[model samples]
Target: MSDAQTQKVLDHIDADFDNSLQRLFALLRIKSISADPAFAGDCKAAADHLAGDIASLGFDARVRPTAGHPAVVAKSNGKGNGGGARPHVLFYGHYDVQPVDPLNLWHRPPFEPVVTDHADGRKIIVARGAEDDKGQLMTFIEACRAWKSATGSLPLDITFLIEGEEEVGSKNFAPFLAANKDELKADYALVCDTGMWDPNTPAITTSLRGLVYDEVRIKAARRDLHSGLFGGAARNPIRVLTYILGGLFDENGHITIPGFYDGVKDLPPDILAQWKKLNLTPETFLKPVGLSIPAGEKGRLLIEQVSSRPTCSINGIVGGYTGEGSKTVIPAEASAKISFRLVEGQDPAKIRKAFRDYVTARIPGDCKVEFGDHSMAPAIALPWDMKALSAAKKALTEEWGREAVLFGSGGSIPVVADFKKTLGLESLLVGFGLDDDNIHSPNEKYDLKSFHKGIRSWARILAELAALPR
Candidate 1:
C-alpha cells in the first residue's frame, strides 16, 4: 500500500487509456434509451453487450431479465465480498440513457460515438449515452479489465449492477436486488452518477437530500364564469392557489409546514465549520443559475440553505385561459405542481400531510382542493466514520494529487436510501462528471480525461479497498 505501488497502478491505467476509450465507444454505440419503448431491443442489446464484455474479465456475468429492460449482473466473488479479510464492493451505474430528443441540436448523430474536443481546449467524448451512463459505467468496467490484465484479478471483490431503467427511476432494480440478495451481497455500494466538486477537484458525496413531489389543485365554482360577471361572488381558484403556496414560507424563508422539521437536525458544528471554510457562497453556488440570493432559512449559511434545509417550490401552474388576447373568464380550476426537497429523516408522508393541512386551513369554505401524485424520496446521510469511505478517499486524493472534498448534494437519489433500508447497505457516491456535462440533455458528453482517468481512479480505488482492514 505504499504511494509508489499506487502510482504504478495509475501508470497502468494511463498506458491502457485507449482501450478504455474503445470500450466506452462500444457501449455508447448501443443506443440503450430506456424511457422509450421503441428502443427496447437496443436496450437489451446494450445489456447483453456489457455482459459479454465483462465476462471476458473472468466475471460470472449475465444479462438478467427485468420487467422493463434487462440488467447486467456481473460479479467476481471471494476476493472478499462476504466480509472476509478482503472487502466486497457493489458498484452501481446505469447502462440506459435518456431519450435523445430534439436530436437536431447535436452536432453529429448521437449514437455515432466519437472522441471530440470541446470549444475550450478540453477533450470530450460525444454521443447519446456518452457521459450519462454508458461512458460513466465503462469507466469502472475498463478499470477492472485493466486490473485483470495487469495483476490477473481485481484487487478486491466487485459486483456491477448496471440497469437499463435508471433514467426511468430504476423501477425493477430494487425487486431484482431483493430476489438476488445473496448473490449481490456487499459491504457497501459505490454509485457513479454524481459529479465532481469542480472540473479539477474530486469529490466524495456524503449526503443526498430526499424529495417529496406533490401536485395540488384548487377548485372554486363548478364552471368557468365571466370575471366581469362574477368578479365579486365567485372565488378565483388561481388567486386561492397562489395564496396557499405563497404562504408555504415565512418572512425568514423557512418552510412553514408543521412537523417538517420533526427529525431534521444540524450537521455537526465541526462539519458546518469545515463547510464554511469550503466557501460555498452565493457567488459560487448561484452564479451559474443567474441568481445570488440564498433563498432558504434566513440565518443559515448558504451551504445549509441547500444541503440541510427542506424546501417547498412550485414547479409549474396552470389555471385561467388566455391563448392570445384576454378571455375575461374565470377558470373553474387551477392547479400547481409543488415539490418539497426533504433532508435526512424528514418523512415524505409527514411533509405531505403538513402541506395538505396548511392548504386546507387556507381554503375558503366555498373552495375545494384536490392533491395529485408526483413522486417522493427520503434523504441519505452516511456516517463520517465509515471505514470504506476512508479507504476510497485515500485513493481519490492520490489519483488527483489534490485533496478530495467530502461534500453533500442538494439533489435526491432515492435508490441510495432504498439500498440502505431494503438491503441494509450504505452507498459511496463518486464520479468524474462535471456540471457542464449536460446530463439528461441532448449532446451530453463526458470529459475524455474523465473517461480515461476515471478508469484509473477506480483501479486505484479497488486496490485501496482491497487493502482495507476488514
Candidate 2:
C-alpha cells in the first residue's frame, strides 16, 4: 500500500462522511441500554444491526450469543498481499450504552439522534452513546468501508469483536473471549474506548491504573448507646474507623501502608520530561473541580500524580445517625467503602490484603473489624516500544498534524487486561472522545469533527499497520 492509496481512501472518507454520520445515527437511535433488562431486545437489535452492516463490507460477520448480551464477530475476507499472511488486528468496541436516567434533563429525546450546535459553536452529534463506543467504533468501521470501496479490499486482515455489555462491566465478555480464543487471534488488539488529551490533541493511552475496592466495618459496642451514658466509658466505632483511615497517608502525601509502594516504580526520565512539557497544572486540571492542590505524592507532577501514580480514596462512610435536629447516640457499627487506584507492578490482591491488614491491626481488643471484598483488577502497562503503538502514533500524528501524546490514564478499562490474559495480545488504545463530551450523562455528544477525522485517523492507522514488518 502506497501513500497515494492511503490518500485515495482518505478522500473517499471525506466524500462519504455524511452517509457515515447517517449510519451512526441509525445506531444511536437504538435504545440498547445493557444495565436494564427491559432493553435486552434492543441490545440484540444493536448487535444484529452492526453485524449486518459490517458483513456488507466483505467480512464474515455474525452475532454470537454470550452469557448475557450477544457479541458481533466480523472477519475481513482480505488476504495478505500475494496471498501471504498480513498483519492481523482485533478491533474491539461496545455497542451497548449507559442507561439514560433523569430524562427530563435532556434537551432532546435521548434516542432521537440529531446534529446540534454546541455553545462553543462546535457541531456535535447529540444522543446516547454519541462519543462513547457507538460513535467511536463507527469511525473504524467507516474507515474499513472506505478502504474496501476505494482499493477493492482492506490493506490487511482484520477481525472486529464488538460486544454489547461493556457499559455493564463486561462480566461475560471475558468468558466469551476465553471460549472463543482461537477465532479471535491477532497480532494485537485495537481499542477505541479512550479519550484524547483535548479536542485538538490526539492521544494513545499507554497505561491504565487498576482498581481494588473494599469495604471495612468496625464494631465496638453490641448496640447503640446513649452519648451521655457511653461518652466516657464506651468505644465509639466511628472515631476508631476515621482514625485508622486518616493514618493511611503520611505527611508527604504518600500512602502509609507498609508495602504499598513495594512494587511501584517511577516513570522513565524521558517520559517524565515529555509529561513536563504537557504542563498539566492545578489551574487547568483541578481548578474546575474546586480543588487547587496536588494532593498525591507531593513532589510528582500533577499529570504523574493523577495518571501514573497509585492512590487511595475513601468513597463513602456511614456510622452515626441524625434526624431533623440531632441524635445523642453512638452508633454500634461503622463501615466505609475504600478503593485504591493501582499502578503497574502493584498486585490488586496484595494491595487489598495490605489495606485490610493495616486496618485490622489498629482495632482495639474489644472491637471487631470485618472486611468485605468488592472488586479487583490489575493495572495494564503496554510496552513503550511496541511496533503497533509506534505505527499508530505516527499515523495519528500524520492525520491530526500533532504529535500524539502517549500518556497513562488514571481510569481502568478491565477488558484491556482480559485481552492480554485470554488472547495473549497487547492493546493499542486510540480514541476521539473529549473531556466535556458528557459521556454517560444527559445530552451526551460527539464532536462532528471527531467523528469525521476519527475515520481518517483509523484509515491511516490501518495503512500503517499493514506496512509493519511481519
Off by over 4 Å in 2: 78-84
| Model 1 CA deviation exceeding 4 Å by range | 1-5, 78-85
lDDT of 1 by residue, 349-453 (tens): 888888888888899988899998778888898899988788778888988888888888989887798789776899988899998897878888989888887
Can you give the TM-score per candidate against the true fold? 0.96, 0.98
Model 2 C-alpha lDDT versus the unseen true structure: 0.93
**Least lDDT summed over 10 consecutive residues: which range in candidate 2?**
77-86
For model 2, how does the per-residue alpha-carbon lDDT over 1-470 read when each residue is reduced to its tens digit? Answer: 89999999999999999999999999999999999999999999999999999989989898999999999998885331123478888999999999899899999999999999999999999999998889999999999999999999999889899999999999999999999887788888999999888889999999999999999999988899999988988999999999999999999999999899988999999999999999999999999999998888888899999999999999999998956888899899999999999999999988988898899889997799999969899999998889999999999999899999999999999999999888888999999999999998999999999999999999999999999975
Spell out the clash pairs found in candidate 1. Answer: none
Among the numbered candidates, top lDDT falls to 2
lDDT scores in order: 0.83, 0.93
